[model samples]
Target: MFIIELTYKVPATEIDAAMAGHVAFLEKYYHSGHFLASGRKEPRDGGLIFARATSKGEIEKIISQDPFSINGLASYRIIEFKATKKIKAFDDFAGDEI
Candidate 1:
């Protein structure tokens, strides 16, 4: 699994302008099984994406295509982790490793 953190580089206005396209990008990945969950941050400065990928390189390739990144609206920080534990109700989120 990977946690993708996006920190806005441009103004909120610019971010909003790109919101539709950004969401479309996310939707495509969701259908392809690349992204699991995503949402805006507490302060609304940026956003976060929870995803499952075969490797860091694969994740990098997908993220590079996000509208936010392509438009220079935000910067991405990708973190990969193992799910050693999780609630049974959400076990599926941890993928087959659990």
Candidate 2:
């Protein structure tokens, strides 16, 4: 599992301008089963993405394609972790090792 944290470098107006393209990018990944969930941060500073990948390289490659990254609107921090425990509904994502 990977948690992608995006910290916006530009103002809200700039972020809003690219919102449509950003959403399109997210939808594409969601359809491909790469992204599980995503949303804006509490203070609206940026956003977060819950993604599933076999390796950090895979996630990085995908992140490079995000509109925010392309437009230099945000900086990203990728955190990878193993899910040792999760709800039964998430069993498929947690993997048998959990």
- The models' CA-based lDDT, in order, is 0.87, 0.89
Q: What is the TM-score of each predicted model, taking all chains together?
A: 0.90, 0.92
Candidate 2 on 2-94: residue-level lDDT in tens?
899999999999999999999999999898878789999999999999988778888899999999999999999999987776887676654
Clashing pairs in 2: none
**How displaced is residue 48 in candidate 2, in Å?**
0.6
TM-score of candidate 2 on Cα atoms, chains taken together: 0.92
Q: Which candidate is the best by lDDT?
A: 2
lDDT of 1 by residue, 1-98 (tens): 99999999999999999999998999998988778799999898988999888888988999889888898889999999987777775556556631
Error of 1 at 45 (Å): 0.8
TM-score, model 1 to reference: 0.90
Query: Model 2 has how many clashing residue pairs?
Result: 0
